[model samples]
Target: MVPAAVLALASLLPVQSSAAQNHAQPDQPAKALARSILQQLIEINTTDSAGSVSATSKAMEQRLLDGGFAKEDIFLGGPTDRKQNLVVRYRGTGQKKPVLFLCHEDVVEARREDWTTDPFRLIEKDGYFYGRGTQDMKDNDAILVTAFLLLKKEGYRPDRDLILALTADEEGGSSNGVDWLLKTHRSLIGDPAFVINPDGGGVDLQNGRAISVDMDATEKLYADFQLRTTNPGGHSSLPVPDNAIYHLADALERLQHYTFPAELNAVTRAYFEKLSTIEHGQRAEDIRAILKPSPDALAIARLSAVSPEWNSILHTTCVATRLLAGHANNALPQTAQANVNCRILPGHSREETRQALIRIVADAAVSVRYVDDAGNVHDTAPESKGFPPPPLTPEVIAPLEKLAATMWPGAPVIPTMATGASDSVYTEALGMPSYGISGIALETNDVRAHGKDERLPVSSYYRGLQFYYEYVKMLSGGQ
Candidate 1:
């Protein structure tokens, strides 16, 4: 669905860019600049537990300053001194409204003992860059920074103003950067036509070959439920079947076995429609059958059996993530609790999912309650669904399609829903559509973000650098 406006914007002439630097070729300095920026960011600890996000924000601010951006165009502020967000405006000819680009500065906590190499240090070995944020993000941060600097240095003018926001607390915390900026510094990032987020979607590769260039159109809502039961304690030797542990365990088992009904929205349907064209044989047949007025039950079963992703896309998933039961090994558990995390499909509220879980457990003794990020327990969950997805306008989709075809020849661009969540939740709630457009490619099996030995392919980082360079230009009306 290419917007008619995109085709018309190309005919406009390029005026003198506001903050043009020294004349330099776009391609020559991009690779080196990207690597340096990524290395600096990776080594800096921006984790919520033992790092300062504002440190990285300042470092990045220095990079833009050196690239000749006016100091007035850049602003740094957040909820706290330790967690600051960086927002920079790349001035254009003002032919159109601004476009906001968002990425987070925080990475999940990584321990040295868990990773083979230092998680904070960028170690390039065996064709990969191993670091905490390599896959989860920082790589895209480098890509975006490099693109802005390169474009600025090359004097490339755009038709619309471009806003770049590298913020903090996206991983998890009370001081969320996106929510804060939109609340406190509204003018810093004015209402953009739409947003481009590098947090979720990109090229999905299998066995070193590109499979699908996924554009995350929407994502599932994230919610956590606390399942608990309490009973009178007894000695281990006198354990009873009606104990707290048994009741809680039984409830969790029921939830594990129960599957939510199959659901699909326009984005997911379009995802499979485009994917079916790229697949072959029985896999292809199964995908096509799922699109019929009455999707074949056998087809859903087959696809769900082979791919966890397809299964998640077809259904809302809730699983026990953590459990705490019993005070000591020698005593019967007096209280037992398990945490159930659910990724609800769009069009469903948190309260609706909580009610569904209560029904699935079907035990009056076991209580289901919503848990907030700050660990507060509530009697009920929110009755609101995730912000509705906006239309897939042409101005956004067309440029990515054109660039993706050129970069990854066979990888077709398909709009897929993110099974997980990102900070785009805040902006999307404001009615500005956000599309996940990370040009970084990753193998299906090698995704290690927030886990041990998180890494990104060596070549993938460089390709991402080029992707944003051309992509930002194309969408902003650059020649």
Candidate 2:
């Protein structure tokens, strides 16, 4: 729950629309270009298996080269030859530091058998664009590329250098695109004012109407813990009381009843404060109550139980994602393991959660260990004591609020912390403040990112294109 004093910083004023006046509606040619780039990206198999990120990187590199970008300003390489990243610089007048527009080109694997339509092909049906990367992020990749091309064609020079990075392996792989870039090619992406990641923030829609524009300033840390219990093997016909499978089951049951204490930070505090105004009935009341100096504990509990998203936002969440038992069904289980995936609260340490899990399990025989392929236990970010999240500076917030008001009047712009992780963590760790401000809006209930039949609304796609085009211009001092 949030504190009432935090609401004092909330600003509901609309920003003057000077950039909007300067920008014109996206014409047919621009629309066609955006669609073409999006379709090309979606059709290229960028999945982990049976797909090569190098192919997509090469294609995008060619597009920039053909668009009059200097060969030196463009870079396409990665730790591995197969997993490549593309970094392009749109030089400005050097009046201010560079601003990075970052997005991942790799997408979650989508099988043909799992989707009703070809997941790799961009298809427009029922007022929606159905595809794998439509929502999880090729949409933003296309929009950013389209904006870059349009800006170049129109001769709209920015006040500062604008860097566009389309990286690989955000979904899951040994060669993470952003990590590789930071380690190998840090100079390619210069020190920036801040990063605007379209992968994070968006408008939340309900009943086809805009509710709020969520601007993600921070995200939870992702960590996986392996819980294992081992015992001597025996024949199944002579079952023993001290069985590995039974001990593992007991630990899991205890974990199911355990819940981390609800914690709040600046981003989450402001989130609940603004959301309280829009939500109705008891939920709204509970939200408001939680913001008070003396918050109602019962109300917090009630709200936490209502939705999984709500629970995650309020607390550090751990759930068993995978399980393994005996080698053979006929033999007593010699070993059992469970993969407990946890999305830790920002500024919290993975070791703290690991300790908590061990304490909760309360079994000396059960071993809890952080699972990392590299075996580097120190890879997790150290925990900070208080709410040490990145601030929502006026430079970033003003434009976003103004744009949200311009696009969907009356909708409040709220800063949020993502329960899921993103590549932004890498940049933030490198001392550049990163934000998720993707202009694409989606229905909150129907978000199919990383799921089967992922899609985005047709109207939303075009709106996002226009929003980003103007927003980038504004950020670059166009008005």
Candidate 3:
């Protein structure tokens, strides 16, 4: 009962054999190298733990040395003792400024018991390689390293010096990683024409399909502040006008009620305008209205209600995460504190956000302060040698998108604005246009990132190998 056109299309497709499916190699040597590197990485417990990076760095250093990278070029960057950073450089012909590939070797803590397999051991089942750092970053690091080593092995030189930085402690802040490296090793990344941090930006959603070609040109700001209040302590039996907890609750209520002004920036405007053309009906009209210079509140309201993913694109959002104050069950607490985190659109300053928060609380008793001060704003540079994402070029994205299309036909390329942050923050802070690009392919609805049983399909690992090999070759001005 299949339609004639469908049958005809199926007939035209080349039959893929079982062996081809099982042992499919996209650039066999590169695939083997990337997979091998990843397995070694997963084996090391490189969290913020005591001995994490030492072992991991040693393994990576040995690998680089075996590939013939100069021992001096593989020195560590960070505090002398614990897990530190790793840097590798590949010399190229002096035709252009070098393209710096930024990567972080640290990962978030993973609970051993919560996982179906040993999170530190790379487990392959039904074509998926499951491990702790599979998605959030190891996949990115693996490809870049493989590409660097391959170029070296082939004796191919790039137009500019290729600098590869793998830093530590990104799961926390750059305290131990890029922060230290940038401050101490400025000469290493200083002369680069532009840089690419694969930590932000992604494909955009179009119609019911995702446009896989879009890349994040910018990222929202991150601000974490505390809402604190103090009041007179008394016995539980005595009534008070407003207790610490009560004041905090009232402030939370007001914050939840008030919505920040929604202003679509240039990047988001371009994003939606492109999507509207590909979508249909109300969805299309809604997108069109949202992109207008002066979008109506109704349009904003509708879009915000659609998804947190979409709401983030339009307005700044605040959420109360932690609370502390009460001491004993029967005793009245003297002070109470609530933690509020906000993700503001790019170009919004942390100071502006802090002031807005003060106004929102509007309570005489409460005082506010920030928890992490990693500078919540991106410092954009003009006349940089690249496109909208200055340091990250259209040159790089073009090839990456082409790779994605070739690897997964029918998968749309949608430029994305990531809600979460990554080590790319360090590169961005250095005024390098950084992005979070990877070679993994996921179904439209799969959510494997930073989750238990985290995994990447075996095909994705191999495809990434090929893409990076091609990418490095092109960037280096090679064949």
Among all candidates shown, the one with the greatest TM-score: 1
Sorted on lDDT, best first, the list reads: 1, 2, 3
Worst 10 residues of 2 by lDDT: 1-10
What shift in Å separates residue 167 of candidate 2 from its native position after superposition?
0.8
Please state every model's RMSD to the true fold in angstroms. 7.1, 4.5, 6.4
All models: lDDT?
0.84, 0.83, 0.68
Runs of candidate 1 with Cα error greater than 4 angstroms are 1-28, 277-282
> Among all windows of ten consecutive residues in candidate 3, which has the lowest summed lDDT?
1-10
lDDT of 2 at 445: 72
Q: Candidate 2 on 36-68: residue-level lDDT in tens?
A: 999999999888777888888899899888988
Q: State residue 315's C-alpha deviation in candidate 2, in Å.
A: 0.4
Show where candidate 2 strays beyond 4 Å.
Answer: 1-25, 277-281, 373-387
- Show the colliding residue pairs in model 2: none
